[model samples]
Target: MGVEWVKKSFLVILMMLLAFTMSACGNTSKAVQKTEDGKVIVDFWYALGGNLGEAVTQMVDEFNASQDKVHVNAVYQGSYEESLTQLRQLAGTSNAPAVVQVFEVGTKYMIESGYIEPMQTFIDKDKFDLSQLEENILSYYKVDGKLYSMPFNTSNAIMVYNKDMFKQAGLDPENPPRTFSEVSAAAKKIRSHFGTNVHGFSVVTHGWFTEQMIANQGGLYVDNNNGRSGEPTATSINGEEGQRWFKWLHEMKQDGTLGDYGRAWDDHRAAFLGETVAMYLDSTASLAGTVTNAEFEVGTAFLPTADGMDPQGVIVGGASIWMMTDIPKETQNAAWEFIKFTAKPEVQAKWAANTGYFPITKAAYDQDVLKDRYNEYPQFLTAVQQLQNTSVTPATQGALIGVFPEAREKVVNAVESIHGGADPIEAINKAAEEINAELENYKRVNQK
Candidate 1:
């Protein structure tokens, strides 16, 4: 969920490759492992940290313990970008991990370079029911209509509110804001009710909010072939809608209703968890860890939309399990078994229940365990509904620049300009221009 934990990390790694490189859900990580002796060791590199990292390690440990045929060694790669560079460098050599968690945006590059193996082959060979996975999730990693990766922990944007602040503001805690006006109004109400003790809404003045606003308004994030990764060129998103969204945030930040970025991603979460902010826009996967530790009762709602526009469109955000090429078939098959095992409905339900990420398979949703979860945790259902209603529109397919993550950093820079009172349209345009330059360089250097 969010920007894709491993994805953004590995993207930085790739960014570090040139400049250098650069670069989820759930309460639980379910491991339905089988033990088969005298097999092989499969290396997995992940970029997640803290609880998410621990959960991943736990899953890997269980997977390893489950079978004698495979020993999956889990390693912590720096970030999405770092991992990507490692993957690229390891290529044509012998350092590639058997499995790497790549961001959704990197799907095309992996698919195109033929560095990663397709999941369909793994699926066919394993004989798992591919039908168990939701079509939208499956399509996320599909390029030219072929399944190239397997969806694992999936998440989407959701509104998180502080119940104490809501109650103090005389608003219904159970009914958090569902529209943009409501978001603004509620934030104002909370600010007045709590004085400077609490802020209403929090977001980094960066490309993240831009993407969220654009998606909610149904604006295309990229052009060409559904914004699939291998598109011929990068498109500019510095137009009217992007301007309006960034401008609004600029205003909010000025008015103090909006919050700023802390040191790291978790710092933002910590900001909310610390109760300095009343509402937060973040990955739905945070529910598992956040709710348990939050001082105030927590509430979650669908991401709010502007008036007159349906607030329904959502983009799939998270990393997928990618199998490597140029590896042994035994290792590939072993990796496939692990992947298939993880995708099973029973496994999916357990993982969903444990972690805040939505289960990628249908059986997980249909299971009695998940039914109980839906009844118990309404937030999970909200994410599920948004994801299921998802359309593979270009806007929702997400951007695919060669140095896409770097381009996003440029977007953050543009927003920083706005925070300093720079013109919103001009700032975005400048950012877009900078991004295009990076895009061109990537295309030229990584040209097929």
Candidate 2:
């Protein structure tokens, strides 16, 4: 009986040891991986795919080859929304990536999540030079006079026009419309000359365009100075600027000038590429794709402003690189090194040339490579000039609310409602009401 009991105990101990080994093997996926050469591996999860993804991979490879202390593994985690969801899922876990590229709208939520190590933390610790950064681009990521993230790829909304269509309509292809009134006039001419199959203006009823228009007028989207001062309590989108903006869209739709592309930004791009739209508002980052896809001469300009108001600026649209907390000190330091390397003027110039995103450092514009590239394609310089012209005001600083992404969807809904013949003011007011309620609930739940 004693021998039989010993045999049973030995078998149980062996099974437990096997289970332990399997568990250890399952946890090999880590943010910072180590190589056989004992070099620290830093996993970088990014949102870009396709050509943009290829550019990022090249940058990562160059970064890896340039140094032996750290190896950055760039992982494509799908879209920005998907990447943010994955990051949230991995919070407080060992599986989180050491670094992430978060979009502009996700700024407030990322800050509230408390899972990131502010860039200021490292900048202060290492006494990094912040003076070399682009002041306008960096200002968007700042909260209370402090930068929380490192600007990576920054872009602005620009007007992409079909130059051939402009010539056909007898409008000056060299001078695109600079105001909403001028846009309407040009669209009218385009429609009149080219008939119904061609659209004068096409845009994805995206809240982004609306936001850009408001910023151009030096207006705010949410109260509390576009959420820069404190926690935003209410949305001011239904105010004068928003009303006039939506009214223009409604009138354009009524006049058969503005063609609705629903909420899909890609559809608007396709329309432009297909030569179905004369002018559209899209990100400067899409310039490369626009130039590649369109057979006609494509022209780029700053987003049109309201008739009376001078253009203040368009809000920068793009993501910035953020470091996660709970990572090893060594890993954090290594990640900072990679970020700094990427921020170098030459590196940024190459990235801008490849991805069509404006370089985030002013010095990048001074590089001969970037200069030559800009000379060849002067359309690239429109956004650069716009960014330089834009001042860092609270309204232009961009809205920072924990519920901004959701609120933007509501704004889209409002725009769609207006396109569907709903009263612009009423639709905007209703959307604002819904957004304000959501913000209140969010504050209560998050205890912010």
Candidate 3:
């Protein structure tokens, strides 16, 4: 009986050992992998969707094919907010991606997050020529005289209008409105000519538009030079510049010429395409798609400024590529190599043509691919010219607030409130107070 019990126990122990070995083998197979040729693997998390996402995947394929030293695994992580949320959870972990794409407004948060390796480190180490890139785009990513990330997919707001509607309204199709008053006048004329069938002008209930309007008038969004010189203690959106923007919206709303499409970009674009709205503000990144999709002849122009204010320029509104610190050193270097490839003029030209984003490298303009694209879509020149014509002041450099996403939400609420007949001054003031409180809370939590 004792011998029989010993044999059974031995069999059980052998079975447990076999199961453990198989589990260990499965985990090893699931671990991060390298190419058969020993190329370093890089995991890249991106937020763009639809065509933009496809373009990113294409670029990654090209980059992998161009080099044998590195292989990048591109993964779609959903919307910018969703992807950032995922990163927040996975950051500082072995599962974290070697590279991540973060939106422009997340700059301050990223700088304070301690999860990234500033692009400046790689730039300095490799002596990369930042002068080769667009200064206006770079200005937005630079903090305290250091570039934190590499600019990719950069865009600015522009006014897109239907030339057919403009001519019908007795307005010059060649020359679009350049100021708030001009836009209002044009909008009223279009509405009057179309007679209840169409509205004059519409802007998406987005905070980015408000930021652009204020910046165009050389107005700061926050104190301390838009928070670049120092941490901002308060928002300046309640100032004269901001008031002018709000008042313009209020007047437009009162006139019934400003279409209320809510905040969905698709809704606003649909209104324009459906000819329910004559003109609207949209990102330059949408230029190609808008022109291709519009049934009428489309015209592109610079964003309107407040009357009597010279255009300070629109801030670049897009995402940049950030390197993660939790990645292995070899992987980081591989990621940097991929980043440098993305910045190449040829690559930038292809990306710009495919995505309608401004090529970060100025030399991309000299590339035949980009030149051909510009020639084919002449409307694309307006955005590039607008960006080139902008003065790199603190206002145009854009605001840097740790709570910028929250602040933008407040501004959006204020715009909606004003559109809903709330007093513009009161709404603006309330939004400002809310943003200031958020900034204070952020500083308190992040104080070091």
Candidate 1 lDDT at 77 equals: 89
Please tell me which predicted candidate would have the highest lDDT against the true structure.
Answer: 3
Rank by lDDT, descending? 3, 2, 1
**Candidate 3 worst ten-residue window by lDDT:** 23-32
User: How well is each residue in 1-448 modelled by candidate 1, as lDDT tens digits?
Assistant: 7669889999888766764221111111212233355557777888777777887787777777776678887899887778888888875335667788987667767776667778878666657676768877776676666688888777878777888778888999888887767888888888888787678888644466667678777776556643564454654477666776767766676777876654265777888988778888788777777777887778887777776777546777778989877666767777887887778787788778877888888878778877887787665676787777776666666655556577668888887776677877788888878877776787788765
User: What does candidate 1 score on TM?
Assistant: 0.85
What's each prediction's TM-score? 0.85, 0.92, 0.92
Q: Candidate 2 versus the native: TM-score?
A: 0.92
Q: Pairs clashing in candidate 2?
A: none
lDDT of each: 0.73, 0.87, 0.92
Clashes of 3: 0
Worst 10 residues of 1 by lDDT: 21-30
Q: Candidate 2, residues 55-136: lDDT per residue as tens digits?
A: 9999999999998999998999999999999999986567788899999999999887877889998889889888898889
